[model samples]
Target chain A: MKGFLLQGKNLSRLRGRLKSALLVRIAVYLLLVDLAFVFAYPFLYMMVTSLKSPQDVRDITVNWLPSGLHWNNYRLSFSLLGYPSALARTVLVVGGCTLGHLFSCSFVGYGFARFSFRGKSLFFLLLLLSIIVPVQTIIVPEYIFFSGAGFLGTYLPMMVPSWLGFGLSGGLFIFIFRLFYISLPRSLEEAAGIDGCGAVSTFFRIALPASRSSVMVCLVLSLVWHWNDYFEPLIYITQQKKYLLPMLLPGLYRIMGGMQDASLSGGDALGDIYTEAVAMAATFLVVLPLLIAYLFLQKKFVQGVERSGITGE
Target chain B: MKLSYSQKRRWSGYVFLLPWLVGAAFFLVYPFVFSIALSVSDLENNNFTKMFFVGLANYKKAFVTDVEFVPKFLTVVTDTLINTPMIVIFAFLTAIMVSRDIKGKGIFRALFFLPVLLGTGFVMQQLQGQSIQSGSLEVARGILLPEKLQAYLGYEITGYITAFFNRITIVMWGSGVQIVIMLAGIQSIAPALYEVARVDGATEWEMFWKITLPMSAPILLLCIVYTIAASFTGSSQVVDYIISLAFGTAVPQFAYSAAMGWIYFLFVLAVILLVFLMMRRPVNRVAQR
Candidate 1:
């Protein structure tokens, strides 16, 4: 009878433990869902609004959904954005810059990771400084230099610095590569060294091959930054004909006649024709390629960042 | 004539770094010094050849004469102060959540990181609807909460909600990279440490405070620095004003723009250095352990 009473007490304790664990799990899930909604609401709003017809957009009752699918918004924006050319140019610049970062950043990173030399600490400090200083601070002089060099209005100004590992957030890329390379075991490289493989060939053959995940992280980041950035392109490519995708956005706003206050414009016929829906559609189309690429690369991208060992030793 | 092994290694390191070194001289150092020179010299009609030394007049204008400059600069400073801590804390918390052995961890990570993909560029600005003038605060009011709810919630409560959502929007959008860095830091911590703590009769809360936080101190510092840099450099009123000064106006005030940029850069650098100095010793202590 005493043993039976002890077993009952143990069972109740276990049950109580399980109950609190369940409650904690439910609470965690609730918090996660709420945060997720906040993160995702902007995208949802954009998508829904992009599909709304003019009448539906005007209707006060319509908030989340449109009365019907409006394909015309997409159609109009697609044609008006000069989608094909702008997209091609964007791909070209982003691709070139990505390739540039992959080549130069890794090479520089490998050097820092594998070799020790004089002023190494000082160089690293400068690298940190490079990352900290805003590009705008030095852009005026760089612009003047590029203009004097006759590189303005061409893609060279954008692509050359990246190729040399000094482009947009280039120092950070090198730092990422350095951290990743430092984390890797030296046995393979040492073995290759003993085998007379030479440093360059060893890097090309073994080190670079093993650092694929770091490469992936850099590639995604570089591509997205270059794709989204309008500032440098705006400064360098002054000609309207050579405008990159992001540069075209502001111009699109101007053409939509939507830059002025809508109420003051009094909802003119052109404003109605080009409406907020069309603008959202253009924005959607602009981001569609990156979004699709991200969806496919999501798993690898997250894993790659985790494996990059960005938290230094 | 043969070189020592250490000498060869040093030479090769320089060889690999040659491109970057040259690039830095031109891209970083020259531009850095040249901008300093430009700040003190007035240029007319984009003609550097016709430039004249203005003797600190541009800096004086920014500080003393230009009414728009000081107020806008202060706004940016205050905004950075408010936003940086929020981004860092929110990111660390979210990183902890997603790093847990939860189901759909990948999806949660992706959603959390969506801002890194879409937040910076034209799409976000366009979506925020006033395009040029609308800040994140305007964005929250315009879209996040419905018009009816704002009316129902009344002016004061709605103002509070709008402000809350404004901060949330900014923090969530900016914290993506920080979250990734923090996650990496947490995951890199040894499981053995946690096991030992548990064996010592420590609770989950204790383990987090004693093990997770201290071990990730270096990364926490990094995330703080990165978020601070992003806040300063990424789209802000000061940056926009500088851009307009240099390019947007009919007669571009290149020297004035350079002066203003330098002021902003110095302020940002000062803040970062102060933070680094404050955090350095603690981070090193944890690292030594």
Candidate 2:
């Protein structure tokens, strides 16, 4: 009787364990869903807030969804913010800078990895230490130096540095490229040489092409970084026409405030709150292109991060 | 021909490195020297030629009389200290979860990483500006417990959570790279060790501490460094404040601003150094074992 009772207890315990396991799984799933929501809510909020009619924006009792989309906010913001010129300059600066990083950083990396140059140790030390220089600390002198040389308000202030391989996070780029090149077998270079490829052509045809993934890594990263570099552009480009996307987005708030929209004068004192919606609309417009680019290049970006950004091994 | 062959290899290296050499001089070395000059001089807005040396006065003024700089800097330093570990641990835990055999892992990974891309240039600026300007600091109030629960936990624990509460967005946004790094670390841990641990009747929890954590020492160190560096350089806290002071409408105090930047940077370096020292023993032990 005692043995049978023990079996019965054991079976009951087994059933209880199974039930708890199922419960735990459900809890995990719920937690993950909540995390996803937390991560996504801001972007979703940005989108919903942007599309709200100015009335819906100020009404405290309104539902989460907008009653009607207000498309005019985008148009008003664009012209007032000088969107066309800002967009052009942003592309020119960011695009040119990314190209410069790819070429300059890779060139340096190839040399460091493949050859024994004079003062290599000193150069290497500088390269390593350069990683730690806070961009803010140098801004004062850099600005003075640039503006003193008749560059400041021009794109040259940013473009020239980028072309020289001294743009933002340039050291990290060089490090990553050097690492990638080092890992590639030295036999490959000898093979290229045996095929009568000169050093320049070998780098161009063999080494460069082999570093396609690293190039993608630098390209995507540099593009995003330069595109969003707020302070460098802020200090350098004072002209409205020279504003980048980051610079222009903030300026749109002023433009929205200046707009003579009839919807803003609802006399509720709370009607002043509609500017929040307009500001969000302006922000959404700024982020839209990058989001589109991200959607398409999502796999490549993540892959690059995995391969080059933080691979510990 | 033999000499030429050997010399060609040496010469080509310098040729390739020329751009970076120029960049180092103009971009790296020059700025560093110029920064020292500015910090030690009574330099003012765009006035390059008429600067006078002021020794450590600007640095001293930052602590003694400049009310805005000292308190603002201390708050930022404290915030960074509290935030970095929380972000690293949270990322590690989340990475473990995502690396499991869960459904829709790809989508979740993408969603989680979206913040990193968004938080970079304009979006980050907008987020900071909006929260500060629009007085939405109460956004994290949703995380508070019921009154009964709070009472049960008492004020101290609850207060700690509340203090950490306001930093939720910064933590979450700052964690994308860390999560990726942690995921890679977890994945890199040898599967054979876990199989052995299981055979030896080890629970998943034990396996984590014994197998996973030890194997991931280097990666964890990397994550800590990355977290500290990213938060220091990326955030618009003290750096932004200094920038504003440097370019404020009244009159730009270049000397004072340079001194302030250097002081803030020292804190960043100190934090990184502290973490590296703390982790070094465990890392060496792990390697030895």
Candidate 3:
């Protein structure tokens, strides 16, 4: 009877401890949610303000919530931004850049990881230096070179270097692939080699399949960078029709500013000046594809990011 | 192994390296040498034509005569000093918190990472209006919170407090990439260390300082380098000033802009190298010990 009583007391004590721990965990969870809200508030505000009417947006006091959703803002934004053409151009540039980087960087990475040769260390050091050196210093010469090649105003200047595996090597993609290749088992390759497979075949049959996660990681990063890139397209493509999304949005903003000048003579000037709400809608349209891509690929993207050791490696 | 076959295989390795060798020679090495040459030359007749070599004259003009150089450079430096510490600390703390068991961890990671995807230029423009407006809004709201408390504290204390506030906002905006990096670092650490600490009856705070901090040093260095690089590359103030000087209505000159870029590049290079050397020593010691 005494033993049973001791057991009951001990059980009660354990239950109390478990309840307190659960409470602590809940508190931590709430704190994390609050922290995320703090960080995300600006983006939410931007989205909300975008939905507000021009008059509402321009008010001296900021409104935390829109009075009502303005759907026409989006239609106006599309026409005002010339967003269709911009979207097409952006897709072309990003797609072309992605393909170029994948082909060129993968080949180069394969070569470095698999081969042993003279000047290999020296070549790797040069690659590292390429990463360290700021691209700004080289922009002038690159512009001059591209102009001389008659590749200016075309997507070639942006897309072709990636094909040559030029700027892509210095990025973490190369290192990640290299490390991944190092960790891969060599017996598969050895067996293939013994079966009369060529180097290219071995790479295709064995290494390529093994590095899918790394490849996905590279693709996502390349797409993001290329999509967001404003400066290169700005410098190279002076033609408004060929401008990518980033360039196009800023150009639209500029055009909007011009239209805002009531002194303009054209009949179309007033029509071209989008409402403030429309401008916000236009911003959303510009970023929509990226957001869509992020939504679908978020799982693979996170996995790839976690595996790439981007912060740690 | 047969000696003859080994020799043939070794020679084939050189053949495999041919593409990268050609690429480096044409793209990297050539441009590096050409940059040095271009930096010294003078542009004539609308930037399409070039004149004779000007030696260190361009560098001299940037350092000695350029009006905007010093102020822009100072702004960059000041911003870097303000922004980097907050980012590093917040990233570290977030990593610690997220590393623990929690619900919706993935969503939290995504939230932190979303801003990095927004890129610098867009984010800066968004911040430009919001930051200015928010300052006024806060004042109008008459919130007697941190700012009021700081004012009551001495002037130096107030300055530090304001500085802290500026950094926190910057950090909150910029934490995406840093948080992702820190998360990877935290994940890479063997869980066994934590388990060992728990066995030793170590407190959470003690374990964090003793184990987490030391193990995370490599990643911390990477974060510092990335943050610094991102700051210079992404600063809208720098970009706007330079672009205006380069292509703006006021002096549309390529040579002057090139000169300024070279100067900025040199300064950044010096700082990066110094930091690299300092960071490298600790990593080496850690490896040795």
Candidate 4:
């Protein structure tokens, strides 16, 4: 009604209002663009700088666009970092973790959602506490325990926890899953009971399929978290062959340059430019798969977040 | 006593929770207990094959005699306190904007949330720290205060501002989850309430303050907690100090490191508990009112 009236009775005012609204919209868009650039420029710089030739990267002026793709930077990184093997190792670790979280955390979530057993609330509180306490606080002794048990230098510390449903962010995943499960109708359980289904069977057959969206959320989160995990691997896995991409990233400049020189982007001198490009290249390699996966799975991820928010469970 | 049907059903719940229970016992509980023991004991070995029980000596050393632990942890805490408001405000404001009927909102959301997909944990800290320092130092230097203001504020404040500008991108990047949560909070508000507000001639600003903000109080509290917890996480200086105390030196004083960790953990726990207590009262009052 306001718009219709403004269109005729206050035509001049409508023009002024439309102009102001347009100006405001343009300003908002500009702000958003600035923010997006701020968020994106780091990775964008990584990709662009990696492709720059040695001379192009080292020049005094900042050049955002590379002259050409320096696929050699990737080739060098691929060979130097043992990219194939490391990528496979990461995949194995991350894959195992996602599976572990999907099955085990969901099982735990089902228990929390369905049960009113003695000490259930206490156990749940403990679960919440686990999420709050910094794992770093316990790492001193935990690391010692692992090394003492000869579990250090292997994937045991990282993988074993996941297998047992206590992996990185496991508490949160279980919480999410429990929220999802509790939202299910009580009639489903009764129906399953009438159909001669046990709790385990019912969960496997009914609840698991029903909570597919949450499961996807857990899978993507677990996969992404495990894939990008640098610290745990840094602590536990000492073997060069076992190092994930991130752990290898800091060392790439050193390995590629074969010099005890400073970090990759040393004083704007030309000497370190090639290594800087190589470092960016190595970073690109590490994050490429994640970027691709996010591009594909972003819809599902957003949906999951929306659902979780709506329930606020 | 013989169990009834409901009793059996209740007991069977434990069977389902057995894996997480056992994992929690070993992973979190046992490690926590071990941390307490290691903190109190007199252990100077790298691995813990050799140790002697000494009551609170490690804690005493960390708390009383330590040249670095308390101050270093406090520095991290201070850093967090300064940065938390900016991150949360940025997240909340951006979320409200994106939630409004706007063009290309999905694109904006995806762009804002890109950080969560890529940057997390130590990798993010290193990437952000190194990238910003080396790549953008010259750009940051352009924003230096004039001579008079710089002199008055001193290098301490001026230098902090410069460094904070360098860190601003990374800090904003940390708000991805918070933004999403707040966005969800906004969307979950009933549209009927908005319609009613519009009928009553409520301005957007008024509606935001009176309705949207108060309605999302629970989520805002969650975001604050997340921000606090995430601040202590990653490669924060506190964690670095603890790690260095345990592993950086030749003779790793595991017990001393454990003490430092416990102290830092207690400090973080206290901050979170305070936030909960502070937020809870207002929420309770709102409920009563």
Candidate 5:
């Protein structure tokens, strides 16, 4: 009878501990969910608010949920925000930047990794300096230089420097690639060379293939940067038609300001308010490509982070 | 050692390096010199030719004349001092937890790392938008309990608390990169060392302090440098403020903005050099270890 009672006590104690552990886990899960919601809520709010009618949005008691769905807000945002033209401009600029980084940075990084030459140390040091030096300080001089060369207001200023393996900071990728290349066995490159491959051919055939992970990392990073970059696009691309997505979204604020004077005379602030909502919607549209890319390639994205040695640092 | 014809491939190496050398000299060096010169020269006339050297004047103006410079610099410094430690702690803790034999470890790792993919600029813009929206919401909701508690601690203390919150918000959004870096560092550490420590009956706390911290010092240094650089470069608030101050309200003329940027650049350079020197000893020690 005593043994039975002790067994019962032990079972209950075990059950209680298990129950508390389960409770703690659930609490943790809930907390994580709450964090995700907090981080994501503002974006959700922006999207839903963008889809609402002007009246619904401006109602005295704001709707946490949209009263009705409106895809027209997207269409309106496109036209009002000059989405098509700006997106094209953005694609061209970002695409150019990515290609430039891919080809030039790889070639330069390979050189730094494999070569022995006079001024090798000095040149590598120069690359490090380029990474550290703030580009803003040189923006004016570069503007003047490019303008003198009749390259200002063209994609040339944004594109050409990158082609020369310049302007990209966080030399971490290039440095990592160099390290990776150095660590790679030289036997394969020698084998390729013996098969009548030159240095360039060996690079293309052997070195490049081996460094795909690092290259992917550089590509994704460069693309994301160019897509979100506001300052350069704002400075270099003056024409409204030439504006990138980031430049265009902010330009909406300027457009709203311009409309302010005209709207006051019309005695209708509704149009202005609606336009502001549309502008916010346009910002959402600009962000969508990146968001989609992130969703799909998140695994590679994390792998890239790890490979870039950012995690260890 | 006797070098065969294939073994002696010196010329080819240089041939491969030619493009980089040319690019650096033309694109990097020339512009760097020109920029330094531009910072010093007085631009009375429109042409680059019509420039006279005015040593220390721009730096002087940045210090004495510019009201925004001091406050902005202080803001950045305060931000760095606060955010750097929090990020380091958060990243280290997260790495340690994820390294443990926990359920759903991969998922937690992935969730913590998602923000790195959403680049700094996008995150900052999102944060700006959110802050503006939430600021209004807090006012309207009269959610002053947290604020009142903060105030009861006294104004300076409350100010720091608020600043700390703001810095953490920034760091949390920005930490995906740092966390991944720290995770990689933690992962690279040999399991045998931990096993040995466990066999020796070392507590988890002792193992972390004795093994994990020292082994990960190199990466920690790298993170510190990267974080500092990112904070300085990626902050739009600072950039916008600098641009506005330099260009006035109407339009950003190229020359004046350039000059103002040089001032900011010099300040940043000094800070970086100081930090680098301070970090050098730990890095050397790590390398030796």
Candidate 6:
């Protein structure tokens, strides 16, 4: 009878522990879902709205689900955006800038990381200033300089600065690379030096390859930034044929005309409702490449963020 | 004839820094000085050829004469002040959530980081336009707050709550990078530390407050600075206003725009400096601890 009582108490205690554990798990999952929804809501909304027909969008009862799939909207948006050419140009600009950043930033970062130089701290301060100062502050002079150099219609204004390690958030990349390199063990570089490898050679052959995570971080980030950069491209690329992907957005409405008429006519207009679907479709197309790339590369990206020593030791 | 080791190192360092040195001299230093010159000069027909010295007239106009600049600038300032904390806190929480040992952790991280890819520039602008331009506010409020709760909270309270919800939508979207950084910071806290805390009878909450929060203070400051920079530079009312003043006006007020830009830049610098100053003691304490 004593043994039975003891077993009963043990079982009850076990059940109590399990119950709380279950509650905690439930709570954690709830919080996760709650936060995730906030980030996911707009994308999901865009996706669903993109798939909705004009009539379905305006129907009072229709909320989440559409009556039928509207592939035509995607078709319309694709043609309107001239997806192929825009994608090609975006790839060119984003690719060049990313490459420029990868090489130039890592090089400069290596300098700051591995060696002490005169004015090093002062230079670092300037790097921080570059990160903080709005490009708008200096864009006027930059515009004048570029226009005078007859480089306004070209990608040089964007790509050249990036190549020299002062492009969009280039300082941050340099900072990241510097941190990662600082944390690296010195014995390898020392051994390489002992074997008569020059500093530049050692950096190129050993240090650069070793900091793969930082490179990945720089690559992914620079790509995203350059891809999403609208203002710079807008200011420089005046030729319609030269417009990048983001530049396509502001003009999407006018290019895909007939929708504005319904928008102008107050409410309950078919054109008004369908325009959203098409616009959502266009937006989705614009982000589609990066979104897919992220889905595949997210693990690497997250790992890159962690291992890049961005949260510095 | 061989160079000393330190001398060799310095020479190599200069070589590596060559790109930045060249780039900065042309792109950074020149533009900086030129912008200052532009801001202080009066230009005819917005051309440099017709420019002359104007001293602080443009700055004076921005402060004392321009009606639209101050209010818009103030709005940007207040928005940043309110938005930055909420973003940082939300990101911290989301980072904690993502850092947990859970199933499909990759999916959660990807979902959370989606905004970093899409939140800025054109995609965000388009989505925001669609929602605001359409009747989505009504739908959003309807979904966010039920009728019973709205009635219970009263009209004014509900209005405030809905407004908060709207703000939170933007906040959540802006937190992608912060979440990633915080996750990294939290992950860097050694598991051994947590184990030790657990052995010492610390609950999760206690462990977080006593250990994680204190340790991650530096990273948190970095996030705050980053958030401020991102908020100011990202597409916003102030940026739009500044750009319009520069280019959108019939006679591009070149000097006036540069002055306003300088004014805005100073405000941003001040805020960033303020953040650093405010967080210094706590961060130093963390370092000491």
Alpha-carbon runs more than 4 Å astray in model 3: A1-27, A167-170, A255-273, A309-313, B1-27, B46-49, B121-124, B132-163, B239-252, B285-289
Model 3, A1-313: lDDT tens per residue? 5666348778798688789879878887877876777667556755775687654655546577666786777878887668877788789888888887776666667777777767778878776666555566566667778888899989887887777676533344565566567666789998998998877778888887877767877787677777877877788888877777777667566655455444234444463335455656777787789878888887877677667644323
lDDT tens digits by residue: candidate 6, A77-130: 888789998899888888899999999999999999989889888888888888
lDDT of 5 by residue, A20-85 (tens): 878766775665564444345446556776787665655647656667876667887788767777
Q: Is the docking of candidate 3 incorrect, acceptable, medium or high quality?
A: acceptable
True contacts kept of each: 0.69, 0.59, 0.35, 0.61, 0.36, 0.75
Worst 10 residues of 3 chain A by lDDT: A260-269
How much is the lDDT of residue B106 in candidate 5? Answer: 62
lDDT of 4 by residue, A130-163 (tens): 7778878888767767877899888878877887
* DockQ of predictions, in order shown: 0.69, 0.56, 0.40, 0.56, 0.39, 0.74
Error of 3 at A214 (Å): 2.1
Model 5 Cα shift for residue A123 (angstroms): 2.0
Itemize residue pairs with steric clashes in candidate 3.
A311-B181
Clashing pairs in 6: none
Error of model 3, residue B96, in angstroms: 2.1
Models 1 onward score TM values of 0.94, 0.86, 0.86, 0.89, 0.84, 0.93
| Model 5 misplaced stretches (Cα beyond 4 Å) | A1-34, A59-63, A194-196, A254-266, A269-275, A307-313, B1-10, B95-123, B129-163, B236-238, B241-259
Query: Candidate 1, B254: how far from true, in Å?
Result: 1.3
Q: List the residue pairs that clash in candidate 4.
A: none
Candidates 1 and 4: which is better by DockQ? 1
Better of 5 and 6 by DockQ: 6
Question: Which stretches in model 2 have alpha-carbon errors above 4 Å?
Answer: A1-25, A82-85, A254-274, B1-10, B43-46, B125-139, B143-163, B199-201, B281-289
Q: How many backbone clashes does candidate 5 have?
A: 6
Model 2 agreement with the true structure over B1-289: per-residue lDDT tens digits: 3547668889988888899888888778888888888888885445778788989998999999888887777777777788888998889888888877788877888888777666775555556565566443333433445668878889788666655654776687778878876876687566888899899979767988988777778778878887777777765568878888888648877788888888877777787778889999877776576
